[model samples]
Target: MGVVNVTPDSFSDGGHWFDTTAAIKHGLGLEAEGADLVDVGGESTRPGASRVDEAEELRRVIPVVRGLASEGVTVSVDTMRARVAEQAVAVGAALVNDVSGGLADPDMVPVVAAAGVPFVVMHWRGFSESMNSRAVYGDVVTEVVEELRARMEAVIDGGVSPEKLVIDPGLGFAKNGVQDLALLAGLPRLGELGRPLLVAASRKRFLGHVLAGEGTPPPPARERDAATAAVSALSAHAGAWAVRVHAVRPTADAVRVARAVEGAA
Candidate 1:
């Protein structure tokens, strides 16, 4: 999966693709770079970010999603709103990648089920503005897995087929650096849930901290792509079904290398 943030404040490459034409071009570029799917998000869910109104979000993403799908690209609408997912799928989006895992909107599961498209149910505690405060965990990995399991049950009960579900650990949604690392290390445990796993750690703040060392300022988001690629390689080796990344080429190469190594082994 490749990320195309259509909002102006997504923490990484946000303003760069805020324009409709630019966003479509970027999605096409990601497709050319070997992304299996291009995920277009209209809202900025970065820590401390405020929410965009439903109207604006719909305006921002629909054109991009329609444009990409019209061009024969596999597109996924990255939104928590059932209405947006419904419209996007009607216009040809192949999937719905909801960061809220149907927790934000009561209609999301039914929308997905009716559309008959694949859905990505990500682990999220709350909306972006207050999510940081909800980061507390006894054992981050175990807690995340348990929470995701509960979400899976809710979505399944809501009429979405289990086979159409994909789970994402949501690296920075409500997690501190340590918790993020723990989740990455615990990928196999997440896989035990019997759903395909999506690792979305592309250029996240935790990787910047890991690269910065103690007491140093972390590098900017764009500079963290190489580190993201490294994580992509490791996550693929650990059995991740897909990786959502801003820069797709390096990670695409990394996944190939990891696959080759595993096949040889």
Candidate 2:
């Protein structure tokens, strides 16, 4: 999966692809770069960002989703809003990549289930403005797993087929640098949820912290591509079904090589 943030405030690439034309072009580029799916998000879920209303979000994303989906690119709407998901799916999006895991909006789970498209439930708490402050956890992996387990049960009970669901650990959402590292180290544990796992560690702040602590301040987003590829390799080796990335080609290549090497071993 490759990320195409149509919002002006995404944590990593905010404002870079907010224009419809630029976003569509970027989506095509990602597809050409070997992304199986392109995730188009209208709102910025970056820590401490303000929320965008449904109308504005729709205006930003539906056309792009429709354009990409019509071109045979699998598009996932990175929204926690049910209305946006429904409209996007109707416009041709094939999946809903909800960062809030259906917690932000009351109608999201039912909407995705009713749409019968693949739904990505990312672990999160509250809105982006408040999530960073809510990062307290006693045994982060256990708590996240249990929380996701409960969410899975809710979605299943709400009528979503298990086959159409995927879980994401949300590497940087509410986690501090140490917690992010812990989640990556414990990636395989999420497999206990009995769902495919999608890891999003691309150019996140924690990786920057890691690089910076090792030497100078971490490089910028574009410069973090190699580290992102390394993270993709690690996640794929640990059995992640997919990795959400900004730089698709490198991560795609790294994952392929990692899988091939591991399989040969």
Candidate 3:
């Protein structure tokens, strides 16, 4: 999956694709670069980010989704709002990639269950505003697996079909650098949950943290693409269903190499 964050304050691109046209072009470019699907989100979910009003989210997202879908590109709406998911589906979104995993909105599960589209049930501790405070865990990997297991159950109980679910570890959402690294190392445990895993280690803080190697400022977001591609390679080799990333070309190439290696193995 390729990322197209259509918000002015997204940590990755910081509004590079905020305009509807720019977002559509970026999505198409991802498709051209070999992305299996393009994920378009309007709200910025980085740590300390606040929610944009529902109207603003819809206005930012719908047109881009519509534009991409019209161009025959598969599109996923990365939103937590039921109304936005519903409207995006109406306008041509093929999947609902909710970061909240249906926890943010009561209407979200029903909307997705009723729409019958695939739902990405991410491991979310809380809303982005307070999520950093909720990263506490006894054993980060085990806790994340257990939490995601319960969320999968809850989503199923809410009437979504079992066959229509995907799971994400939600790197950097509530996790610190060490916790995120532990989760990556624990991918097999997460995969044991028995749903396809979506690894979103794009230009996240942890990558910058590792690249900085202490006593230094982390590189800017765009500068982390090579690191992101490295993670993409490992994640793919470890059985991730997809890696959601901003720089599609390098990851696309990286995953292809991983697949070739897997095939040889």
Among these predicted structures, which one has the highest lDDT? 1
Q: Which candidate, 2 or 3, would have the higher TM-score against the true structure?
A: 3
Worst 10 residues of 3 by lDDT: 11-20
Off by over 4 Å in 3: none
lDDT by candidate, in order shown:
0.95, 0.90, 0.94
Q: What tens digits encode model 2's per-residue C-alpha lDDT throughout 100-214?
A: 8888888988898889999888888778788888899999999999988988888888889999889999888888989999999998899888899999999988888877776
Give per-model TM-scores: 0.99, 0.97, 0.98
10 residues in a row with least lDDT, candidate 1: 254-263
Residue 181 error, candidate 2, Å: 0.8
Better of 1 and 3 by lDDT: 1
Off by over 4 Å in 1: none
For model 1, which pairs clash? Answer: none
RMSD of 2: 1.2
